[model samples]
Target chain A: MTSPLQQKLKINGSSVVTANRTWDGIVVYRTAAKGWSADLAEAAIVRTPDEAKALLAEAVADDVGAIGPYIAPVQVDDTGKILPGNLREQIRRDGVTIDLPV
Target chain B: MYAYDEIDRTLVNERVSEFRDQVKRRLSGELTEDEFKMLRLQNGVYLQLHAYMFRVAIPYGTLASNQLRQLAHVARKYDRGYGHFTTRQNIQFNWIKLSDLPDALADLAEVGIHAMQTSGNNMRNVTSDQWAGVAPGEIEDPRIWSELIRQHTTLHPEFSFLPRKFKIAITASDHDRAAIKVHDIGLRLIKNEKGETGFEVLVGGGLGRTPFIGKTIKHFVHGRDLLSYIEAILRVYNQYGRRDNIYKARIKILVHELGIEKFSREVEEEWQQIRHSSLQIDDEVIEDIRSRFIYPSYEKLPHMPDELRQAAADPDFEAWRKNSVAAHKNPGYAIVTISLKPIGAPPGDATAEQMDALADLADKYSFGEIRVGHEQNLALPHVAKRDLPALWKALDKLGLATPNVNLITDIIACPGLDYCSLANARSIPIAQELTRRFANHELANLIGRLHINISGCINACGHHHVGHIGILGVEKNGEEVYQITIGGRADESAALGNLIGPGVKFHEVADVIEDIVEAYLALRERPDELFVDTVKRLGVEPFKERVYATR
Candidate 1:
């Protein structure tokens, strides 16, 4: 696939590609299977800049289902699990930060 | 409440159909995101941080019981079973789906409510005093003029595009509950020395990034020439208002750049030509609109009912009566304000169940009508004094019996970082924390008539600039920091708050406010003195000293 560098975002550390589903506006992360999933656990973690660029490219290429694809910082634990690095990303991953009526 | 006429119904239905087609084209990729953004915004669809939020106007904050029931139905069917009432007398659904927006609009249209002009740089929903007709010491009902302005501004070809969004508020009472001084245009109905009711027109007041108290351009404009005078002001702003920068595009900026004298002169020069045109309101038309808002049939009863007297002996009912009820024009009746700011719950939020119950209460106690106050509370404008005890019991069952009107806990907050895409910090959590800190009703009552407003960003969606205690959220080095302002009041003596000191961390905000309130308590001459009055008496220096003492 031809990589479009213009859509590339500045990345500092371990990250995952994320976008919002266009239909429902839910946050979704790119998975290792080259598809979007709502669950952050299924997100494909990239440790290096090149890996993040490739994942972002895959996310942007799937434009039919999502909007505003970008790489977001993630933290990896000793168990090799991923979590959003910042409060905004964490809130996005886990719906509203406060309690909301279901 | 003004019922939708045939023209209004046709216009709403047509707009919904147009939006439905636009959504279809956007989904099919026939239109780019840039092309669809404006169209969606005009339809009141905002793409926020988590999802789409849809804002529906409650025209002049008046709603029929059936109309409110329809809103509840829309919440249950399309959204997440709840809606957030906004400071601008509107209701917003936070978790709306882009795909379901068209269907939602159509459903809302069936009840004569729409989301038109709620977003975009157009005349937004005209807000007015929540207790428009019921409040005593009034010249006339402001909602009549609010509805007239709504009709004139709706889909007006000339003002559909302006330098920035415009807002207008009308208040007939001298108390000024509508925050008229902070609106783009404030119309106050006042009687002349000759007993003729006219409007004192104030212009160019707004709060976003640049806050200014509106200046009275015309001391009194005849009620007949109200529309022409407004049109003249809008024309001047349209021609000379800055369009280059979004931040400096409000009429307030124009009035600031060119002094109010020069701006008033220009508006006068423009009004000289159009003052006698068709825009001059006819007396008969005014009377026609007035006739529609006739008082509901009231029974001839004594001022104090026996049941109310007996309930006043009960401490619980007396507590509710102290905070939740207000004096009405009719001696036998009172205005009831329902608190939406329950402890630990988001301000202005109502579940579908709560909304339905409120509607049923309106049918039973009120005259099948409800009003949304600018403070994000619901009011039953005309409830008999005898029915208050039963109403309080019913509201208690629904967890809506919090008696904190104008108290420290009755906070006004905007959906900040949690939902809004443009927010720099979160407002809801701070409000919740402050509410928890002041959960004691006795302490809150001791602090009498304190208004705490929180905005997530500089946009001032929460009217923080005019709050008795204003908290603004800002981002510093990627972390949220809150700045506090003191002594802002939204009444007749409207004044902007003064920034006390440096920004505090989110965890310190509640403590800072507590210190400020404690200082006010210590300094007040008597218990009857309000916090705002105390701040006015003792300058911001004392409050600032107490707040930053620990820093």
Candidate 2:
């Protein structure tokens, strides 16, 4: 069972922004898609390489009016400098662009 | 006496600009009150009930004459002609306006002072022994490590927002003058088996609603790796510490819940990852910082002057000598404590004129060196014993010659509901009433050595919990109630006080205290029976019965 903080971290968009990083949790991605609020059932948690690819695909699909490709990870090193590891950079390279409804 | 070089100057200048921009943006309503609140707090700006307060850091409680003068100028110009020295070895100007904060920071920067990390969850002002360099028993100056901590923690990106606010205190001497046991991180410099000095570090100690004496986490942390070790501890705290509940957020709670062995092992594990990194003490950097704290060359002098000998023979000087003077490292010199606790005046308060006079006297008698202790008292740490009479005469004219150093009337009280936003009752008026209650010097001397610390709230701003006779002011319904605790101590054997039944009404508090003191007088073990010893022998039962006879 996940706590509200964990559930909140699981959702990339909606009111819950990325809180902090954990060693083995899904890195959240905020969606630009309108009318798409994160329900607990819809939240993603990836553990495998296939699941990671699926998460990136879902995030790109949800970027209808692509506001950002901001990767929100839970943890970082002691320097407070953000780390973009291989997985994160691979996701960033597959960024999508979407036009917003005026 | 640490002097700022180019890096220090540049950092302070950049911070000034950042604060200036923050102020402009705040005033323009570009940021919300909450956002700006955190920002201002990060810079040590507190909005009290009446007005904004600017708490400036007096690092390790040492101040040059020029810094003292600059603080005085700020009091005269920015504040309402006075600043309050706090328990953390910081000075606070209570009446600063929101708009004037930038100007105040600029003025402070001119004297190499700032409010940075004086508040917030980051490392607060690194405090050490106020009598750091001059104390006779000091192995080495703790101010060196204090400065190193100050530099290492300043704007450290990783540790800015931790579980709760972190406080570090250092003591170079065997005596715990810095109150090391009650701080978050307490370091005592000790000579190890290798005949080299290093720090014995204690962690997880603080006093508020929940007080815990710090535990020794590390038996010996060498002079190097101080920064990285601290960083590792902070990172562990930041990552796993409770953020949902503010009360359980302090590292003490973590240490308590996880057990010290586990907590310490975790910290050690984290420290192993970053042990000898760039965060370790760079020799060049240490040398650069250490060079600033080197003592100024003093002229060699004889053991004692004839004038000092004659004054020591005088009766009045004899009394002052017994009370106000401390042993000096330099012969023919003494540390003079100018008691702010006058017969009728508020303790720890010096009017603007009094501050100026003290600054002048510092320049005249004490080799321009001044130190403000955690007890809100000022010390001229290097006064020539021969100039005692001259110094006494000058101080007498300024109304600062109270001759009540550590006496019963030297009450430590907080700025209560009158100024503080978190206060439940007024502390200054109670302190004043008690001062007038015990007006006679003979009576005060008769009571012997008793420390009465009164706090308006449970925040322990006045450090009431550690007083020999602690009074905590709480609000019952709409009226103020005073709770009395006996046998509390803040000395080498510091202990939390035991509560004496329920609290007394505000009007009857003075009378109740008088009754308690009377109880002490009647239960005389002897004339030399200090309050703590009596309380220790008889326990708090006698005082409790006297205080709450009708309850």
Candidate 3:
């Protein structure tokens, strides 16, 4: 069985546009409503390469809200939920997995 | 510790205001990401995987109690509830927001601390002997000179934009507590036959993709000529160091390409032209430098009081005192090393409450001063011998008395993929796993003085190249694996570790370490031989053979 991190790394066609929010450096995704959201569920998923490029371009033009916008490979689950495609992105999405001091 | 003067105060305050304006411009879409990155980096801000990591200097690992409380305040106000102490002895806030940075800098500056040149390609915070003024068999305090270098290097106009980041480490003792040999420029204070304090200078040493033990260029530099000589070396590096290749741009590469003898000649030539100029330090300047520093007042008590022996009656206190306490130059005092590595917590992390508690304890017992060791541990360098029992009980309550200094579980690891953006795999989890696997105190005591360091990439931020047992994280195919090295040490005789064999899976790291430990126990010449010594007596092949054959 593959590790959870390895499983996340195996992308199957789905992608999304993501960036860090400009004010606080929080990870945010380009939403289908032409805005940004911290939740991956509200992200605008693009399966085709051209669609990913267009979505990335739209995110880049909205640089006033975020920084370093780029297209990232994502994975679609059986329940139609979007998951981050790699461990780095997954970490950015869910925060640090380990227990940090409060 | 050196207090900030008027000029220093102005510069820091100006930088804070400048950063506020730049941050405003960035939010308003006036400055692009590329344009604002260098500015933020100069102020010790870097974007990590989760958020912006703001690094603040401890200035040669020395901190006052109130200064430490200010760090705790920053931790509570601007960052998460904790801060990570880095291998360089600086503190890093891993979850700071960009919007809160200007206020954070201003607040930190009020306590005479700023993050200037903490992250940029400028001379970084100078690291020195943690037991600088108090250690036995020491010359003059190294902090006086470390502070001098710190003053000279902060926003130095000529040396600001060097080829790459430079690090300097200094020591005043024969024993290498500062690991000076692994630095870009290592300064060792030695007394001549005439009994004058001078420096033995070593140049061009570094770690990362390339690691070199610093080569001594000058046998002795007079106290007054120290700054002149250092400036000459930096001038030569600024003129000749490679700029086209970022990977090969450090002074180590330049020194390697030029050969040490030729590099020495160039530095000498530069020194001759500028030695007597305004950069030269006179006796008055040295006196001024000495006057700027604050020294602890020793009470002049007898060595090893009866209360110390009485306190040692408990076996648990005995264990902690043996591992965590060291002899002080002054009698009736001991340097107490507080272990930041609790069994399951991150290696160098301290929560805000813990920081506040430790700072107050430091004020009450350790003369209101604390020193951060390069090994990611904190030290109360001037604790009275009489206070051992009380200090130990307090520390035990705080969960900082782990009795694992220099033991197997006291691991040195970088933030890696958890916080750093440049890591290939996660290193903290590997360190955590190893720490948990070796949680047995008896087993840890038996397998003593093993330095296990982990880095996620070739950057060697964890100083893995010099660890007795080094682990480097890399991704194979899609999953993470770790490469192990044996026999490396960072000391007066610093040497890089050699790779043992192929990379191992993350779950297999603990087993691999245990096998190596068992093999060393079986193969060592005597029970007292260090693991590095055993690996040296017999090369990596013996340990390699045992590990691979067993697996």
Model 1, runs deviating above 4 Å: A1-10, A14-17, A30-35, A41-64, A69-71, A76-80
Candidate 2: share of reference interface contacts reproduced: 0.00
Per-residue lDDT of B433-461 in model 3, one digit per residue for the tens? 88898899988888878999999888999
- Candidate 1, fnat value? 0.51
| Tens digits of per-residue lDDT for model 1, A52-91 | 8888877776666777677889998889888888877877
What lDDT score is found at residue B501 in candidate 3? 95
Taking chain B only, the TM-score of every model is 0.99, 0.96, 0.98
Task: Please count the clashing residue pairs in each candidate, in the order shown.
Answer: 0, 3, 0
Model 3's alpha-carbon lDDT is 0.89
Error of 1 at B331 (Å): 0.9
Runs of candidate 3 with Cα error greater than 4 angstroms are A1-12
Top candidate on DockQ is 3
- Candidate 2's residue-wise lDDT over A4-76, tens digit each? 2223223222221221111111223332342222231222334344444444444433322221122233323
Tens-place lDDT per residue, model 1, B182-263, is 9899999998999887999999898989999999999999999999999999999999988888899999999989999999
Supply fnat for every model shown. Answer: 0.51, 0.00, 0.61
